[model samples]
Target: MSASPKYSVELIDGPSRVQFTSASSILRPDGYHPAGAPHLISSATAEVYGNPKATKTIRIGNGGLGPTGALRQLCLAFLGERPDLRIDWVVNHSRHTQVALQAGSIDVALTYEREEEQAAETEGWSRTMGILCHDHFIIAGPRQDPAGLRGLHGSVGRANDVEVSKVKPLSTVAFANIARSQSTFHSRGDGSATMHRELGIWDSAGVPPREQGWYKVIAGTPLAALQRAAADVAYLLIDRATFLYAHHIGAVRDVEVFVEGGSELMNTTCILVRTEERRGAVLEFVEWLQGTEAQAIIERFGKNWELGVPLVTPVSQLEVAPHGKRS
Candidate 1:
């Protein structure tokens, strides 16, 4: 425990959702190891795409991830909080977090969303789930709106004041409004998790931007794309954490969060371990991540970022995570 909670994190259930992970594996086609190949296990002081390492440590598959060092900071904080447990985190973006942990080449892994469902779907792998934290989506665009994107939905994107008052998911409506007005919208088109969610919201709104002239797919990392969106004065879906990083760097001063809050905008990351592996260290870290101590670290994380808003919201339980819980 930090013993002095600077910022309070909304307490949620620990590491619950298991969305598709948003990182990449660094192994080559035939066999290429970062540290001259492996001897045993499945990772190292690095992440394991599939290469076997030589340590039995709990290999959390997140590091130096996101724009503002959120996950990497979390890893550092965890180590600070619990010195007894040593974690070798490799920044992983491939689907192998599940495969390595499932195949017993590793102990546990932390990855993005719906992991519980996907874990269940995978025939023979046994895994237990916990809610780690949430990095939510913020619909951002130019401060000057072309589609009345902000005023039409108000602060939180609820369609209460318009003729389309019947309402759809406000997030969906936000995108639909962009299309209805043919407002320029940027798509990563790289099929990243953020991109996947953006497209899903469009589908949910029944207005896919398949061939619309207003829809333009942009290329680059999330930060680069965000900078592009700001330059073009276009609208795009961006993760709050990355947005915080971009904001810190002054990459998106012209953009503002138009639609946020509500579960539809949530992007969850979960901590997973084979229930059978049952490593005391893994279990301790997972439980502690959701406990008061680690949550305090997550709570005060953004104070370091120098941003007024916590990049990621604590929602599942401040008891699933409530960034909306300002203490």
Candidate 2:
């Protein structure tokens, strides 16, 4: 499952180095079972691959989360539990989940962008099969939260408690305040889903980071950016899981989640399947993901994630309703 080599970011998996024009890059690891390899599909696996003793492949993809070891942990656990299905898991740009699914480069995609999920289903090429988790963001900053962003909740989950018409989400307001205060702020600047969402927040705040001396873009993954922000005592919006992972690993010691949760801060992940293939089988796997076993794995998996912190909320356990609006 290779894409055209016009990428803006480098896809590094072990020894392979591939680039593409799309912000999303594909990481096809070396020595993995080749696509279309013959394997004996089992009963449970047949629900996804179909038929025993047949050659079939299912390509699963996510945004650049593979480097975090979160997606890899989930994929390995799924394969370990099933043992009957062969998967060539993929990592691409999160912002391009819909494009990859539409291009048929990946059979299924775990996407954080709710708009993309709705668009693909509306276009009739894809269907959202399950809600994996609602991973929200954290306004990572110094201990004091000099920007005064603490306790600022977005419109999500606050309608019943606050004035529904007057509240603006923190995703927008926080960034604007960060800019107005001229406090330091770091950005990944990479094409990953995190970067896209950060940009969207800034845009919603009506203050793009363009030419701002205070806004700095660190070159690396989300973990790397957050670490750099810690060193600089700058504020940056980061995914909660990644921040917790960094904390658990002891890599980022200074920054913490000052503010989080809201419709705008919700990075709700959905398991999407291309409807053109064995949709029923993929749907079966999706069902398992939302099941207890997979949900447990999700709750437990994460390299830098701190245990008992609930970095990522399983769909079954989230306070917000599945397939429901956050704000």
lDDT of every predicted structure (CA atoms): 0.60, 0.62
lDDT of 2: 0.62
Model 2, range 7-75, lDDT digits (tens) per residue?
243334455544433322232211222433321111111122222343545667775445556665666
Which of the numbered candidates is closest to the native, going by highest lDDT? Answer: 2
Give me the runs in candidate 2 sitting further than 4 Å from their true place.
1-57, 81-84, 150-166, 279-281, 299-307, 319-327
| Candidate 2 lDDT trough over 10 residues, lowest sum | 38-47
lDDT of 2 at 22: 34
RMSD of each: 12.3, 10.3
Q: Per-candidate TM vs. native? A: 0.68, 0.69
Which runs of model 1 end up more than 4 angstroms from their true locations?
Answer: 1-57, 63-66, 81-86, 92-107, 119-122, 154-165, 304-306, 315-327
